[model samples]
Target: MKTFKSASAFKPQRQTVVTIGTFDGVHLGHRKIINRLNQVAKTKDLDSVLLTFFPHPRMVLQQNQDLKLINTIDERIRFLSDTGLNYLVIEPFTIEFSRLKAEDYIKQYLVDQLNVAVVIVGYDHRFGRNRTANIEDLKAFAKTYHFEVEEISKQDIDDVAVSSTKIRKAITEGQIDLANTYLSKPFVLTGKVVKGRQLGKSLGYPTANLYIEENYKIIPKEGVYVVCAEIDSKPYFGMMNIGHNPTIAKDNRKSVETYFFDFEGNLYGKTLEIQLLKRIRDERKFDSLVALKAAMQKDKAFSINYIKTLQ
Candidate 1:
């Protein structure tokens, strides 16, 4: 698949069946649109493309910066690439770019640049200047431009619409299971393993510390989790604790410490992708090191037992 950072760079000669959205998590609802595009492209023998924005339109348009996101940029790109689309256009969302009128944008970017033959839109998606574009507006633009417009509805679970914001809320409130249900996968964190205090090593449960990325992808509030740790390209059973280390004298830095079960290797500077499986226990400040070690041991046992049930 080809990638273009802006509409001007798009040079596809073949007719394109396109879908536009942030597609942040590419959750179930997004997949419905993708399926629609796939069907349209296959029937029409046109190239299917996805257009999305960086810095999230909200981040560029709002005063308050939202920190938490379900997926990083790389994760989103990788998944979209794997979806068999012909192109993934990632354009920057700047003030000037955001100010384009609906017709101007549809003409300049979609028809003139992308050469779109068909546009697949989500049922409730809004675009264009002042967010005024609706499904009817899109259809009118398609009719005027001699292109096809397909509007796909949101896929719901238990009668509630699945959305990125709702998923974020679930993760924030520690409703990980609900978030996972919406995401169709576990809400995960990816980071680099860094050198740490070696406190877990002292307790015979060595842990790899994580250096978080700047995106501030949401971390579950201080707790132990039955997590799947991916390191050196293999997923392993493990447990992770995220919080200020309350066992020792308190400090200001919050940390993520994960211990790989029945595995030994050099983790320093390696990347770890942890799939948070289930919350085992809330973080607590133990009175002594022995108490902390005992609690960790129990957590490990609980995680192993839980994972075995899944297997």
Candidate 2:
């Protein structure tokens, strides 16, 4: 798929069939829309384009610093890449762009810039400054611009909305299986491996500490989880603990550490993408190092059994 950093950078070689949204998680419902888009583009002999925005609208409009997203921008792009889209345009959302009038936005983006032959949007979609334009307004504009406007049914839009909400809820609650069911894939965490206190090493369960830079990325409930990763093209299964090492440390800083089964290698500077498969148990403060180590051993055994079932 071809990716354009911004709408202005996209020079359409032919008229396109387009869909616009944040497409945050690109969940099953979003995929349904993309499928219809590809079908329309194929039937009409036009290219398909997905126009999405970065720095989500709420982040800019409401200054919602506390808002957490299911997937980071790069992760969203990675998921969308598998949908067989012809083009992707990641437009930067800003206060100035948000001020454009409905008609001006349609003329500037859909007509002049994208040369859209057909525009697909949800039935409840709104546009322009303060979102005053509705699907009816879009159809009226389409008549003036000589293009087609398709509205996704209310049911499909509802499913998309519900799934996004459920996915976030599941992740925050440590319901890994439920979240994966809604997403149709495992919830993933991508970051670099950094040095830790090596407490795990002393306990015979050496771990790789993960450091994620995106503060807005949603983290699962503090607990132990079953996770999988692909390192050097080899698949590895492990158990991850996301919490403070209360049994060993006095500081309150939270950490994510993963201990792979039967694996040993230098991962100090390596970046890893780990997929959460299942939740094991909640993190607790043990009475002693011996008790903590025993609990970890049980977690490892449970993780191995879970992995076997997948095989």
Candidate 3:
């Protein structure tokens, strides 16, 4: 998919079938709408364009600092690229932009700019200043704008039985299986490998520490998880611990550390994408290093066996 950071950069030669939204996680629900956009675009020989917003609306409108997101904007782009979308336009969400009237938004951005042949949106979708315009308003404008409007009913969306909220909840609750089912992909964390206390190496389970820069990225609950880390396009099986080292540290400072099986290298400063496969156990405080090591061995065996089953 061709990506444009600004809507001005997206100038489709052919008339476009478009859908607009934040598309937070690009979860199954979002994919349903994207699928319709692509299908309609293909059937009508029009371009498929997905106009999404960045610095999520809530982050701007509500000043929601506590808002945790399922995927970063970059991750959302990668996820949407696999859906056969022709164009992905990321509009910068700003106070001034949000003030556009309903008609202006439909006309300027959708009609005049995109030359939209058709617009696919949810029945309950709201747009324009203060989100005053509903799907009804969109349909009314479609008649004036000379574009067809395709409304995806609640049923069509609810059939997926997934929402970004539910996915975030599942991940926060350590329900990796459920979250993955909803996402149609594993919950992932991409981060740069950083130096740690080297405690894992002493335990004969040397680990690569991960430090995420995106503060809004939703982190899974504190636990040991079965995961796969991709580095330089290669996949490595691993188990990750997300919590304070209760046994090793006097202060309970949280950290994300993963021990990749049969792997040895200097990964410091390199980025790795870790995909959570399943949760093995909650983070627990062991009485001694020996107890922790013993438990780590068991977790490794379980993870390795699980990886075998997947293969």
| Highest TM-score scorer | 2
What TM-score, to 2 decimals, does candidate 2 have? 0.98
* Candidate 1 clash pair list: none
Which structure is stronger by TM-score: 1 or 2?
A: 2
* Candidate 3, 39-152: lDDT as tens digits: 898889999999989898889989998999889888899998999999999999999999999999888899887889899888888999999999999999988978998888
**Looking at candidate 1, what is the lDDT of residue 140?**
90
TM-score of each: 0.91, 0.98, 0.96
TM-score of predicted model 1?
0.91
* Candidate 1 structure quality by residue, lDDT tens digits, 27-74: 777776687788889999999989888777777788346566678877
Segments in model 2 whose C-alpha atoms lie over 4 Å from true places = none
Best by lDDT: 2
